[model samples]
Target: MLCIKKPSVASSFEELIPKILTEGDLVETEFGERTKEIRNTIIEITNPKLKKVPEKYPLGEKAVEEYRKNLLYGSKNIFSYDYHERLFEYPYNEERINQIDYIIEKLNQQKNSRRAIAITWNPKIDIEVSKDERGSVPCLQFIEFLVRDNNLHMTVVFRSNDALLAYVANALGLISLGEYIAEKTNTQLKSYVHHSVSMHVYIDRDRDYIKKYFPEYLKYIE
Candidate 1:
Protein backbone atom coordinates (compact mmCIF):
# COMPACT_ATOMS: atom_id res chain seq x y z
CA MET A 1 0.00 0.00 0.00
CA LEU A 2 1.43 3.34 -1.02
CA CYS A 3 0.39 6.31 1.11
CA ILE A 4 2.33 9.21 -0.29
CA LYS A 5 1.85 12.63 1.28
CA LYS A 6 2.87 15.29 -1.21
CA PRO A 7 3.99 18.72 -0.08
CA SER A 8 1.68 21.64 -0.78
CA VAL A 9 4.08 22.98 -3.43
CA ALA A 10 3.98 19.76 -5.45
CA SER A 11 2.36 20.55 -8.75
CA SER A 12 0.36 18.17 -10.88
CA PHE A 13 -0.76 14.64 -9.95
CA GLU A 14 1.26 13.22 -12.86
CA GLU A 15 4.40 14.56 -11.27
CA LEU A 16 3.85 12.12 -8.39
CA ILE A 17 3.65 8.98 -10.58
CA PRO A 18 7.33 8.09 -10.80
CA LYS A 19 7.50 7.87 -7.03
CA ILE A 20 5.08 4.92 -7.02
CA LEU A 21 5.62 3.28 -10.43
CA THR A 22 9.39 3.08 -10.07
CA GLU A 23 9.19 1.47 -6.65
CA GLY A 24 6.00 -0.64 -6.67
CA ASP A 25 5.47 -4.37 -7.02
CA LEU A 26 5.51 -5.98 -10.49
CA VAL A 27 2.90 -8.37 -11.83
CA GLU A 28 2.47 -9.88 -15.30
CA THR A 29 -0.89 -9.65 -16.99
CA GLU A 30 -2.31 -11.38 -20.08
CA PHE A 31 -2.14 -7.97 -21.72
CA GLY A 32 0.97 -6.36 -23.14
CA GLU A 33 3.48 -5.47 -20.44
CA ARG A 34 4.23 -6.34 -16.85
CA THR A 35 2.28 -3.85 -14.72
CA LYS A 36 3.60 -2.14 -11.63
CA GLU A 37 0.80 -2.28 -9.11
CA ILE A 38 1.08 0.18 -6.26
CA ARG A 39 -1.72 -2.02 -4.81
CA ASN A 40 -3.49 0.54 -2.59
CA THR A 41 -2.05 3.97 -3.27
CA ILE A 42 -3.62 6.97 -1.53
CA ILE A 43 -2.04 10.17 -2.75
CA GLU A 44 -3.36 13.58 -1.75
CA ILE A 45 -3.54 16.54 -4.06
CA THR A 46 -3.36 20.03 -2.60
CA ASN A 47 -5.64 21.37 -5.30
CA PRO A 48 -8.86 19.79 -6.48
CA LYS A 49 -8.26 21.21 -9.96
CA LEU A 50 -5.45 18.92 -10.97
CA LYS A 51 -3.71 20.94 -13.70
CA LYS A 52 -2.51 18.08 -15.88
CA VAL A 53 -4.10 16.96 -19.13
CA PRO A 54 -2.77 14.46 -21.62
CA GLU A 55 -2.49 15.17 -25.35
CA LYS A 56 -4.65 12.18 -26.30
CA TYR A 57 -7.70 13.11 -24.16
CA PRO A 58 -7.73 16.65 -25.59
CA LEU A 59 -11.06 17.54 -23.95
CA GLY A 60 -11.62 21.13 -25.09
CA GLU A 61 -13.02 22.85 -22.02
CA LYS A 62 -14.32 19.37 -21.03
CA ALA A 63 -17.05 19.36 -23.67
CA VAL A 64 -16.35 15.96 -25.22
CA GLU A 65 -19.59 13.97 -24.92
CA GLU A 66 -17.87 10.71 -25.75
CA TYR A 67 -15.54 11.00 -22.79
CA ARG A 68 -18.47 11.86 -20.55
CA LYS A 69 -20.35 8.75 -21.63
CA ASN A 70 -17.34 6.59 -20.76
CA LEU A 71 -16.27 8.30 -17.58
CA LEU A 72 -19.01 9.81 -15.33
CA TYR A 73 -21.96 8.41 -17.26
CA GLY A 74 -22.43 5.00 -18.82
CA SER A 75 -23.78 4.42 -22.32
CA LYS A 76 -27.23 5.86 -22.94
CA ASN A 77 -28.19 2.55 -24.59
CA ILE A 78 -29.44 0.09 -21.98
CA PHE A 79 -31.57 -3.00 -21.73
CA SER A 80 -35.19 -2.92 -20.74
CA TYR A 81 -37.18 -5.54 -18.79
CA ASP A 82 -38.14 -7.26 -22.05
CA TYR A 83 -34.53 -7.68 -23.13
CA HIS A 84 -34.94 -11.45 -23.06
CA GLU A 85 -37.39 -11.67 -26.02
CA ARG A 86 -35.76 -9.06 -28.26
CA LEU A 87 -33.12 -10.03 -30.78
CA PHE A 88 -31.49 -6.59 -30.44
CA GLU A 89 -30.49 -6.61 -26.81
CA TYR A 90 -28.84 -3.83 -24.88
CA PRO A 91 -31.60 -1.46 -25.84
CA TYR A 92 -31.73 2.27 -25.28
CA ASN A 93 -33.15 3.98 -22.20
CA GLU A 94 -33.81 7.60 -21.51
CA GLU A 95 -32.37 7.76 -18.01
CA ARG A 96 -28.73 7.03 -17.23
CA ILE A 97 -28.22 4.27 -14.63
CA ASN A 98 -25.06 5.92 -13.30
CA GLN A 99 -24.72 7.55 -9.90
CA ILE A 100 -24.56 11.22 -10.87
CA ASP A 101 -28.26 11.74 -10.41
CA TYR A 102 -28.27 9.87 -7.13
CA ILE A 103 -25.34 11.97 -5.98
CA ILE A 104 -26.95 15.26 -6.88
CA GLU A 105 -30.36 14.44 -5.49
CA LYS A 106 -29.23 12.74 -2.30
CA LEU A 107 -26.46 15.16 -1.49
CA ASN A 108 -28.74 18.12 -2.12
CA GLN A 109 -31.40 16.59 0.11
CA GLN A 110 -29.17 15.43 2.90
CA LYS A 111 -25.57 16.60 2.89
CA ASN A 112 -24.52 14.23 5.64
CA SER A 113 -25.59 10.98 4.01
CA ARG A 114 -22.66 8.66 3.52
CA ARG A 115 -24.13 7.01 0.45
CA ALA A 116 -23.46 9.53 -2.29
CA ILE A 117 -21.64 7.21 -4.61
CA ALA A 118 -21.06 6.42 -8.30
CA ILE A 119 -20.25 3.07 -9.80
CA THR A 120 -18.83 2.55 -13.31
CA TRP A 121 -18.49 -1.21 -13.71
CA ASN A 122 -21.40 -3.42 -14.67
CA PRO A 123 -20.57 -6.99 -13.86
CA LYS A 124 -22.80 -8.47 -16.57
CA ILE A 125 -20.65 -6.91 -19.26
CA ASP A 126 -17.37 -6.61 -17.37
CA ILE A 127 -17.06 -10.27 -16.36
CA GLU A 128 -15.37 -11.27 -19.59
CA VAL A 129 -11.71 -10.44 -19.19
CA SER A 130 -10.61 -12.20 -22.38
CA LYS A 131 -13.11 -10.57 -24.73
CA ASP A 132 -11.62 -7.66 -26.58
CA GLU A 133 -14.89 -7.29 -28.44
CA ARG A 134 -16.51 -5.67 -25.40
CA GLY A 135 -15.24 -2.24 -26.42
CA SER A 136 -13.35 -1.63 -23.16
CA VAL A 137 -14.15 -2.32 -19.54
CA PRO A 138 -14.08 0.59 -17.11
CA CYS A 139 -10.75 1.22 -15.47
CA LEU A 140 -12.41 3.17 -12.68
CA GLN A 141 -14.52 1.07 -10.37
CA PHE A 142 -16.25 3.47 -7.96
CA ILE A 143 -16.25 6.98 -6.55
CA GLU A 144 -17.76 8.11 -3.25
CA PHE A 145 -18.50 11.62 -2.03
CA LEU A 146 -18.29 12.75 1.56
CA VAL A 147 -18.93 16.11 3.22
CA ARG A 148 -16.76 17.14 6.10
CA ASP A 149 -16.57 20.67 7.48
CA ASN A 150 -18.89 21.86 4.73
CA ASN A 151 -16.50 20.59 2.05
CA LEU A 152 -17.14 17.83 -0.42
CA HIS A 153 -14.34 15.28 -0.70
CA MET A 154 -14.10 12.53 -3.29
CA THR A 155 -12.44 9.18 -3.03
CA VAL A 156 -11.75 7.52 -6.39
CA VAL A 157 -10.96 3.86 -6.85
CA PHE A 158 -9.39 2.46 -9.96
CA ARG A 159 -8.93 -1.21 -10.78
CA SER A 160 -6.17 -0.36 -13.21
CA ASN A 161 -4.96 3.05 -14.28
CA ASP A 162 -2.60 3.94 -17.10
CA ALA A 163 -0.39 6.52 -15.45
CA LEU A 164 0.32 8.12 -18.82
CA LEU A 165 -3.04 7.99 -20.59
CA ALA A 166 -5.69 7.87 -17.85
CA TYR A 167 -4.46 9.12 -14.49
CA VAL A 168 -5.08 12.82 -14.90
CA ALA A 169 -8.04 12.41 -17.25
CA ASN A 170 -9.91 10.31 -14.70
CA ALA A 171 -9.08 12.81 -11.96
CA LEU A 172 -10.38 15.66 -14.06
CA GLY A 173 -13.64 13.83 -14.61
CA LEU A 174 -13.99 13.23 -10.87
CA ILE A 175 -13.14 16.82 -10.13
CA SER A 176 -15.91 17.89 -12.47
CA LEU A 177 -18.29 15.59 -10.65
CA GLY A 178 -17.14 16.82 -7.27
CA GLU A 179 -17.54 20.43 -8.24
CA TYR A 180 -20.99 19.81 -9.66
CA ILE A 181 -22.07 18.01 -6.51
CA ALA A 182 -20.48 20.60 -4.30
CA GLU A 183 -22.36 23.37 -6.06
CA LYS A 184 -25.60 21.45 -5.80
CA THR A 185 -25.02 20.66 -2.12
CA ASN A 186 -23.68 24.11 -1.25
CA THR A 187 -20.23 23.00 -0.24
CA GLN A 188 -16.65 23.74 -1.19
CA LEU A 189 -14.30 21.35 -3.01
CA LYS A 190 -11.93 20.04 -0.40
CA SER A 191 -9.71 17.13 -1.36
CA TYR A 192 -9.28 14.47 -3.99
CA VAL A 193 -7.97 11.20 -2.63
CA HIS A 194 -7.05 8.80 -5.44
CA HIS A 195 -6.37 5.16 -4.70
CA SER A 196 -5.22 3.25 -7.72
CA VAL A 197 -4.87 -0.49 -7.13
CA SER A 198 -2.72 -0.79 -10.23
CA MET A 199 -1.18 2.32 -11.71
CA HIS A 200 1.28 1.69 -14.53
CA VAL A 201 2.77 2.93 -17.75
CA TYR A 202 2.68 0.25 -20.43
CA ILE A 203 5.97 -0.77 -21.99
CA ASP A 204 6.62 -3.23 -24.77
CA ARG A 205 9.29 -5.92 -24.73
CA ASP A 206 11.70 -3.27 -25.99
CA ARG A 207 10.18 -0.59 -23.73
CA ASP A 208 8.95 1.36 -26.76
CA TYR A 209 5.66 2.75 -25.41
CA ILE A 210 7.14 4.72 -22.53
CA LYS A 211 10.23 5.61 -24.56
CA LYS A 212 7.94 7.22 -27.13
CA TYR A 213 5.21 8.55 -24.82
CA PHE A 214 6.80 9.50 -21.51
CA PRO A 215 10.09 11.06 -22.53
CA GLU A 216 10.10 13.21 -19.41
CA TYR A 217 8.66 10.74 -16.89
CA LEU A 218 11.41 11.75 -14.54
CA LYS A 219 10.75 15.43 -15.12
CA TYR A 220 9.09 16.02 -11.73
CA ILE A 221 10.80 13.25 -9.83
CA GLU A 222 12.27 14.79 -6.72
Candidate 2:
Protein backbone atom coordinates (compact mmCIF):
# COMPACT_ATOMS: atom_id res chain seq x y z
CA MET A 1 0.00 0.00 0.00
CA LEU A 2 1.20 3.49 -0.82
CA CYS A 3 0.73 5.96 2.03
CA ILE A 4 0.80 9.76 1.66
CA LYS A 5 0.92 11.86 4.81
CA LYS A 6 0.29 15.56 4.41
CA PRO A 7 -0.86 18.51 6.50
CA SER A 8 -3.77 19.36 4.21
CA VAL A 9 -5.90 17.99 1.39
CA ALA A 10 -4.30 20.12 -1.35
CA SER A 11 -0.78 18.95 -0.58
CA SER A 12 -1.85 15.33 -0.42
CA PHE A 13 -3.68 15.58 -3.76
CA GLU A 14 -0.76 17.37 -5.39
CA GLU A 15 1.61 14.60 -4.33
CA LEU A 16 -0.84 11.83 -5.21
CA ILE A 17 -1.30 12.84 -8.86
CA PRO A 18 2.39 12.65 -9.75
CA LYS A 19 2.90 9.49 -7.73
CA ILE A 20 0.15 7.72 -9.65
CA LEU A 21 1.53 8.97 -12.97
CA THR A 22 5.01 7.72 -12.21
CA GLU A 23 4.49 4.66 -10.03
CA GLY A 24 1.12 3.32 -11.17
CA ASP A 25 0.82 0.33 -13.52
CA LEU A 26 -1.06 0.63 -16.79
CA VAL A 27 -4.38 -1.11 -16.71
CA GLU A 28 -7.49 -1.60 -18.87
CA THR A 29 -10.98 -1.39 -17.44
CA GLU A 30 -14.54 -1.55 -18.73
CA PHE A 31 -14.51 2.24 -18.88
CA GLY A 32 -11.38 2.55 -21.07
CA GLU A 33 -7.61 2.61 -20.95
CA ARG A 34 -6.23 4.02 -17.71
CA THR A 35 -2.69 5.42 -17.68
CA LYS A 36 -1.81 4.32 -14.20
CA GLU A 37 -3.15 2.49 -11.15
CA ILE A 38 -2.13 1.79 -7.57
CA ARG A 39 -4.07 -0.42 -5.20
CA ASN A 40 -4.74 0.20 -1.52
CA THR A 41 -3.48 3.75 -1.52
CA ILE A 42 -3.93 5.72 1.71
CA ILE A 43 -3.98 9.49 2.21
CA GLU A 44 -3.73 10.95 5.70
CA ILE A 45 -4.49 14.60 6.30
CA THR A 46 -3.48 15.96 9.67
CA ASN A 47 -5.83 18.93 9.35
CA PRO A 48 -8.86 18.55 7.15
CA LYS A 49 -9.92 22.18 7.52
CA LEU A 50 -6.71 23.51 6.02
CA LYS A 51 -7.85 22.51 2.52
CA LYS A 52 -6.85 24.98 -0.16
CA VAL A 53 -7.38 24.22 -3.82
CA PRO A 54 -4.14 23.67 -5.65
CA GLU A 55 -3.62 25.94 -8.67
CA LYS A 56 -3.14 22.90 -10.89
CA TYR A 57 -6.49 21.40 -9.90
CA PRO A 58 -8.77 21.50 -12.93
CA LEU A 59 -11.91 22.71 -11.17
CA GLY A 60 -12.53 26.21 -9.95
CA GLU A 61 -13.37 27.25 -6.38
CA LYS A 62 -17.10 27.60 -7.07
CA ALA A 63 -17.27 24.14 -8.63
CA VAL A 64 -15.49 22.57 -5.70
CA GLU A 65 -17.87 24.28 -3.26
CA GLU A 66 -20.86 23.01 -5.21
CA TYR A 67 -19.53 19.46 -5.12
CA ARG A 68 -19.03 19.61 -1.37
CA LYS A 69 -22.62 20.78 -0.90
CA ASN A 70 -23.95 18.04 -3.14
CA LEU A 71 -22.05 15.39 -1.25
CA LEU A 72 -23.39 16.60 2.09
CA TYR A 73 -27.00 17.60 1.35
CA GLY A 74 -28.07 17.09 -2.24
CA SER A 75 -31.32 15.36 -3.04
CA LYS A 76 -31.42 12.12 -4.99
CA ASN A 77 -31.18 12.63 -8.72
CA ILE A 78 -31.48 10.35 -11.78
CA PHE A 79 -28.49 8.34 -10.66
CA SER A 80 -28.93 4.95 -8.99
CA TYR A 81 -27.32 6.25 -5.78
CA ASP A 82 -26.34 9.48 -4.04
CA TYR A 83 -23.77 9.79 -1.28
CA HIS A 84 -25.87 12.15 0.82
CA GLU A 85 -28.91 9.89 0.69
CA ARG A 86 -26.88 6.81 1.55
CA LEU A 87 -25.25 8.56 4.50
CA PHE A 88 -28.11 10.62 5.93
CA GLU A 89 -30.93 8.18 5.18
CA TYR A 90 -29.42 4.75 4.62
CA PRO A 91 -31.93 2.18 3.44
CA TYR A 92 -32.23 -0.97 5.49
CA ASN A 93 -34.82 -3.75 5.74
CA GLU A 94 -37.90 -1.71 4.84
CA GLU A 95 -36.55 1.21 6.90
CA ARG A 96 -34.25 4.19 6.59
CA ILE A 97 -31.45 4.62 9.08
CA ASN A 98 -30.18 8.09 9.90
CA GLN A 99 -26.56 7.11 10.20
CA ILE A 100 -25.34 10.62 10.88
CA ASP A 101 -27.63 10.92 13.89
CA TYR A 102 -26.58 7.52 15.16
CA ILE A 103 -22.92 8.40 14.92
CA ILE A 104 -23.44 11.63 16.81
CA GLU A 105 -25.47 9.98 19.54
CA LYS A 106 -22.99 7.15 19.93
CA LEU A 107 -20.08 9.52 20.28
CA ASN A 108 -21.89 11.73 22.73
CA GLN A 109 -22.75 8.74 24.88
CA GLN A 110 -19.36 7.08 24.61
CA LYS A 111 -16.41 9.12 23.49
CA ASN A 112 -14.37 5.96 23.21
CA SER A 113 -16.93 4.23 21.02
CA ARG A 114 -15.48 1.94 18.43
CA ARG A 115 -18.79 1.14 16.73
CA ALA A 116 -19.59 4.52 15.22
CA ILE A 117 -19.57 3.41 11.63
CA ALA A 118 -21.68 4.30 8.59
CA ILE A 119 -21.79 2.09 5.53
CA THR A 120 -22.97 3.05 2.03
CA TRP A 121 -23.15 -0.33 0.30
CA ASN A 122 -26.43 -2.17 0.59
CA PRO A 123 -25.57 -5.74 -0.31
CA LYS A 124 -29.12 -6.71 -1.26
CA ILE A 125 -29.26 -4.03 -3.95
CA ASP A 126 -25.62 -3.27 -4.80
CA ILE A 127 -24.45 -6.86 -5.12
CA GLU A 128 -27.23 -7.68 -7.58
CA VAL A 129 -26.76 -4.81 -10.05
CA SER A 130 -24.19 -4.25 -12.76
CA LYS A 131 -22.75 -0.81 -13.45
CA ASP A 132 -24.01 -0.90 -17.05
CA GLU A 133 -27.57 -1.41 -15.84
CA ARG A 134 -27.46 0.72 -12.69
CA GLY A 135 -25.92 3.89 -14.12
CA SER A 136 -23.91 4.44 -10.94
CA VAL A 137 -22.67 2.30 -8.08
CA PRO A 138 -21.39 3.49 -4.73
CA CYS A 139 -17.59 3.76 -4.78
CA LEU A 140 -17.36 4.87 -1.15
CA GLN A 141 -18.18 1.94 1.11
CA PHE A 142 -17.47 2.59 4.78
CA ILE A 143 -16.91 5.52 7.16
CA GLU A 144 -15.75 5.19 10.72
CA PHE A 145 -15.45 7.88 13.41
CA LEU A 146 -13.19 7.72 16.40
CA VAL A 147 -12.63 10.09 19.30
CA ARG A 148 -9.36 10.21 21.17
CA ASP A 149 -7.84 12.87 23.40
CA ASN A 150 -10.94 14.99 22.90
CA ASN A 151 -10.45 15.03 19.14
CA LEU A 152 -12.48 13.28 16.47
CA HIS A 153 -10.77 11.45 13.63
CA MET A 154 -12.49 10.14 10.53
CA THR A 155 -11.52 7.30 8.20
CA VAL A 156 -13.21 6.53 4.90
CA VAL A 157 -12.86 3.57 2.55
CA PHE A 158 -13.52 3.57 -1.16
CA ARG A 159 -13.85 0.51 -3.38
CA SER A 160 -12.51 2.53 -6.30
CA ASN A 161 -11.42 6.13 -6.80
CA ASP A 162 -10.70 8.33 -9.81
CA ALA A 163 -7.54 9.71 -8.29
CA LEU A 164 -6.93 12.44 -10.80
CA LEU A 165 -10.41 13.85 -11.32
CA ALA A 166 -12.43 12.97 -8.24
CA TYR A 167 -10.10 12.53 -5.26
CA VAL A 168 -9.66 16.18 -4.21
CA ALA A 169 -13.37 16.88 -4.35
CA ASN A 170 -14.11 13.69 -2.49
CA ALA A 171 -11.67 14.58 0.26
CA LEU A 172 -13.09 18.06 0.70
CA GLY A 173 -16.66 16.79 0.85
CA LEU A 174 -15.83 14.15 3.43
CA ILE A 175 -13.95 16.71 5.47
CA SER A 176 -17.09 18.81 5.64
CA LEU A 177 -19.02 15.79 6.79
CA GLY A 178 -16.40 15.14 9.46
CA GLU A 179 -16.64 18.74 10.60
CA TYR A 180 -20.37 18.36 10.97
CA ILE A 181 -19.92 15.25 13.04
CA ALA A 182 -17.27 16.83 15.20
CA GLU A 183 -19.48 19.82 15.91
CA LYS A 184 -22.44 17.64 16.79
CA THR A 185 -20.35 15.56 19.15
CA ASN A 186 -18.52 18.54 20.64
CA THR A 187 -15.10 17.27 19.73
CA GLN A 188 -12.25 18.98 17.90
CA LEU A 189 -11.55 17.78 14.39
CA LYS A 190 -8.22 16.08 13.82
CA SER A 191 -6.95 13.74 11.13
CA TYR A 192 -8.84 12.63 8.05
CA VAL A 193 -7.72 9.35 6.50
CA HIS A 194 -8.87 8.11 3.10
CA HIS A 195 -8.25 4.62 1.74
CA SER A 196 -8.82 3.64 -1.87
CA VAL A 197 -8.73 0.03 -2.98
CA SER A 198 -8.05 1.02 -6.59
CA MET A 199 -6.76 4.53 -7.25
CA HIS A 200 -6.29 5.38 -10.92
CA VAL A 201 -6.20 8.05 -13.62
CA TYR A 202 -7.99 7.70 -16.97
CA ILE A 203 -5.26 8.45 -19.48
CA ASP A 204 -7.29 8.76 -22.66
CA ARG A 205 -9.59 11.27 -21.01
CA ASP A 206 -7.04 13.37 -19.12
CA ARG A 207 -3.70 13.11 -20.93
CA ASP A 208 -3.88 16.38 -22.80
CA TYR A 209 -5.16 18.27 -19.79
CA ILE A 210 -2.36 16.97 -17.59
CA LYS A 211 0.24 17.67 -20.25
CA LYS A 212 -0.91 21.26 -20.63
CA TYR A 213 -1.29 22.10 -16.93
CA PHE A 214 1.24 19.82 -15.19
CA PRO A 215 4.16 19.82 -17.63
CA GLU A 216 6.63 19.40 -14.78
CA TYR A 217 5.45 15.82 -14.36
CA LEU A 218 5.76 15.08 -18.08
CA LYS A 219 8.95 13.14 -17.51
CA TYR A 220 6.90 10.48 -15.73
CA ILE A 221 4.40 10.14 -18.54
CA GLU A 222 6.79 10.19 -21.54
- Which candidate's TM-score is highest? 2
The local distance difference test score of each candidate is 0.59, 0.87
lDDT of 2: 0.87
Per-residue alpha-carbon lDDT of model 2 for 1-222, expressed as tens digits?
799999998899889988888889888877556568899999999988897987777775676788789878885455677888889988888898889999999999999999999999987777766546535789999999999999999999999999877888888889999999999999988999999999988777888868876777777766
Give, for candidate 2, the lowest lDDT window spanning 10 residues: 127-136
Residue-level error in angstroms, candidate 1, position 37: 3.1
TM-scores for all predictions: 0.71, 0.94
- Taking every candidate in turn, the Cα RMSD to the unseen true structure, in Å, is 6.7, 1.6
lDDT tens digits by residue: candidate 1, 1-222: 777654321244445455545675666766646655567667676577544454433233364334433444444554222111111122235433535666778887887889987665555555663276434666767778888788888888888886655566566666766777788789988888888887765443424444554455433221
